[model samples]
Target chain A: MNWTLMWDSLPRLLAALPLTLQLVALALAFGAVLAFATALLRLSGNRVAVALTSAYTFVFRGTPLLVQIFLIYYGLSQIDLIRDSFLWPVLSQPMWCAILALALNTGAYTSEILRGAIETVPQEQVEAARACGMSRVRLFRRIVLPVAIRQMLPAYGNEVILMVKASSLASTITMMEITGVARRMIAQTFAVFEIFIVAGILYLLINFVATRLIKHAEWRTTPYLRARA
Target chain B: MLDLLDSGLTSGLHGWGPQLLSGTAMTIAVALSSFLLGLAFGAAGAAAKLSDSLVLRGLAELYTTAVRGVPELLVIYLLFFGGSGMIMAVAGIFGYGGLIELNAFSIGVAAVGLISGAYSTEVIRGAVKSVPYGQIEAARACGMGRWRILRRVLVPQTLRFALPGLGNVWQLTLKDTALISVTALAEIMRVAHTAAGSTRQSFLFYSVAALLYLALTTVSTTAFQQAERYASRGVRRA
Candidate 1:
């Protein structure tokens, strides 16, 4: 109802947008690589790889991201080795810690998504590719990977938005992202509703745009399924 | 000593175990209260969405979409701050001018209930739609009233279909309870946070927190699977 305060809070919240975006982008990039490897590891015949990846996913997915962030940020600092080692420079920064936790957490969830998607890729296509003397890597690259990616997009899109929301947890560690700035402003102005509503709108906008981009990608990738114009 | 610490031994947990366990209980209580409340909201919302009234459908759509689209933390903050005032204002209409306090536990349950309700709404709606229309029609033909039909023909099938989706929502509801630590509720996350700050064993306590959450999810997932089996007993599946 405080229209003026809500309007005034918008710019400050907007200023935090880049940090939020950066957390999402970096975490997703790292998480994508981690997820792909995890998915492949589960598919791999090697027992060690499968066990390790499953445990990785289990631990990360089992816990809350906020717990992970605190453990990485405040927790890791308690260790003398991490503080003394070369890792300290990066781990000491709260932003990096947040990014690390977010990436690991998202990685676990996405790996499951990717694994399920890849498994849904029809066995006949892979069989046909193998029968044609296509190498394993080539068969996966030309056939399985493409099909899986297409199927994975919708779920991955959900993961992306979830990551964006997860990024708000980063604010707890003093990242000053959208939610962080809003909390700070609220403390200053006592306009908790105004600031939070503005911040929530900012998050909704990000997710809205993300959902559209994913939907567009889905449409583009599934050309064979499309109706005539 | 370093090896023991590196392995995150229970040495650090010597005194904090009881506190964390109590906090876990609080978290469970809150999660359960919120999950029950959410189920109610979800059922009502699904009914509204399935109703013939356009306005009811629109309002239900708005509730689910808006809550799902926004971050849970923001909604918690919004409710926790604005909620008490709203309650007090309503109470004013009843001739109560005295200051009344709603505890953090209730606020947390109500707020998280609303968030989880949005998710459960989608799941319940899908489950309701999945129920065969012919079955309902057959029930009506048998001279069954609406309530009887719902109780007999609809509820069981919906439960069977909705269990898996509701399992996912339950996991969500459980995790969202962690966010309520931002309030004054002495839940698991807040306890770990406080213990970490005091004991400076952030790694140990948080690892415990993570372990505790993992245990909760694991147990509930198993329970849901059992319930799913029980619900679908004697039913055919592909």
Candidate 2:
């Protein structure tokens, strides 16, 4: 337990916290939209849409995110067509590549969570909304979405924490997040245990705070459920 | 694209088929070893968590929370770099300290096992809880000892309840082996990475790796389904 070394590494690790948070935030934001679309696609009663979304979830969830990250960062760039395209600017940078991979991976998991939540919304509530002559979009907005979001908040919180941890993989592709900084420090100092223990504590702190925020959000959103208590 | 796939698959001409297959085998080996190790740890942790001792329960809680919160990659790195030192110190206590070292495979299994064990502890604990208390009471009333009651009454129902969750943990363990590639282990992901780097045909190798993983997940899912069915035999369902 090298307390001084752990203390010295804390500031450096903290400096990289913004990048880690940025990756997680961007990925979760984009992933939420992608997840919603995926969930809706699965429920749209269109065979092609269902098949496509299912395949998307199956592939992403089945494979390791590291493989996806490497394939996107290193694999996609190998193709001359992509390298020459206008999207090359975004695809070539490690930051964008990491974000792309993280968003796609989290999107798959979040879609499943969202889909399960959506499915669990009572059939009677949806029927009542439809019987009232609410438009399809209105019915979904007024009846389905809110309830589903409430049901899925805890799961989504887990997803967010996972994304935060997953962002560490970006360091593998040369992105200098917290784990990246820790890796570099370890390489230079050979103090692997102390640095990583500090890094682990930093992650623990982030997740602890995130868990509390999620619990607070849950309590706020479910006031009806909490009224009796 | 078809030509690249052909060459990559064919045995004689620059095909990485053999290497990829070997890597897949190694991946399975690592996953299985770690899964078993995880089950052992999970059983112990579940017992500790369910026990009456405050210290035991606190220690179990600490293990689960810390491992669950931290990233798998960081855990692997800590084990990979720090493991040898810890092992050497343990050996020193036994008067056999001659540069104790762990191979990549051992470290990979140990690290991933620790992570898998945390999740498994939760699963097994939940499963144990699901077993009806009346049955255990009945067993005790029948004059059976604790060990006999555990074997005859508790373990069976717990395993049945825990199977699906254990299946998920197995998938998690399988995918986590990818992180062990950082330690330079020649698992499926590592092989794909090395082949991709050398051949510059990154898409082909990585796609193959991804497909291999999907294949493993699919096969194991079916196997688990069969096991679930088998476990539920003679039991009524609503």
Candidate 3:
């Protein structure tokens, strides 16, 4: 291993770190909101709502993110109608295209994770809340949301890490994220292994921190387990 | 508009569609072969991890931990760049002094196989652990040899529990094939990518590719679910 080369490249790679963080952070935040809405609709009693959310999740999760990004960036642009449309501003940039794809894709998976957590929130508790005359809104806000979000924390953390890794795919579409920078460095230095190694270590470090945070959250939530520990 | 769409489809099919078809073939072949390779490694790793020997146990643990800890894309990249050199080095030791020519298919298969093997190791290890020790002891008392005991008492039970996890690994392997585009393998993603770039119609090609993958996932999921049903038929579900 070229320790000197690795150390030297770290500074340049770190410079590109902000965009990578922005991509993952913004996508996850936006995706989380979309996911919550989608999951709620998916669980709703309304047939139309359920059907729409189901189709959305199915289509998004069914496809690879790379395909979706390309479609948004290149495919949709071919149409004169779309090019002239209000959406053109958003679709014009590769960053937006990448974010759109990542958000939509993660939104689908996140909805499923949130849905499972909500479903596992036990029916009896909801019944008890209802018996106390809590309104539906209050019931969901005070009872359902907290439990579901807490349950979702660990899985969502994994999704967050997966998104960080998946963000590398954005490089395919001309976005200069971490993997993009790494590729450029490789192209210049002709050191594919060394550049990728540094990039991989960066990813591993980010994921390691995320995992520890998730574990800490898990510990805090499950006080009973913490007490035993 | 519908007629336009129809004509567009026809034009695409007549143009670069054959490349996409061939890519799909490559994807399936790579996924299948890598999956089989993964199964072999998974079984061995599982056996080693479950074994009493510390050496075998340590080897299995390291294999699972290192591979799983690293990103899949990194693994694929590492194999793509490092695999050739390693193969050539081994060939050199074997006295074959020639250029090492590895096809894209082999590289794709090997990379995905390594990734699948890591996940499969965990799944198969869990499956092996789920097998009842009492059954193994019973087979031993019946004067069955180690191989016979494993064949009769262990393998069947392991498959039953391993099916669901293996199914997940299969879906993962299927999606991971998309990463092979880096190698210029002309898999569905690559074909769609080139078509998108040339036509400047990214949506059409990508949508088609995405649908193709979804179709693959759906069909495979159905097959695995059927296998799961079959496997659990004799045994009662919780």
The model with the greatest lDDT is 2
Error of 2 at A220 (Å): 1.7
Better of 1 and 3 by TM-score: 1
Q: Write the per-residue lDDT of candidate 3 for residues A84-148, one digit (tens) a residue.
A: 99999988889988998899989999999999999999899999999999999999999998888
The CA lDDT of each predicted structure is: 0.90, 0.93, 0.84
Q: In candidate 3, which residue ranges exceed 4 Å CA deviation? A: B1-4, B10-12, B52-59
In candidate 2, position A61 carries an lDDT of 99
Candidate 1 residue A157 Cα shift, in angstroms, is 1.3
> What order do you get sorting by TM-score, best first?
2, 1, 3
Clashing pairs in 1: none
Write the residue-wise lDDT of candidate 3 on B1-238 in tens digits.
Answer: 2343466587865387788889888888888999999998898888899789999999988777666655676677777777777798899999988888788889889988988998899999889888888988899899999999888888888899999999989988888888888889989998988877787656667777888888888899999999999988998667
Query: Each prediction's DockQ?
Result: 0.70, 0.81, 0.57
Report i-RMS for every model. Answer: 1.7, 1.1, 2.3
Model 2: per-residue lDDT, tens digit, B122-186?
99999999999999999999999999999989999999999999999999999999999999999
The candidate scoring highest on DockQ is 2
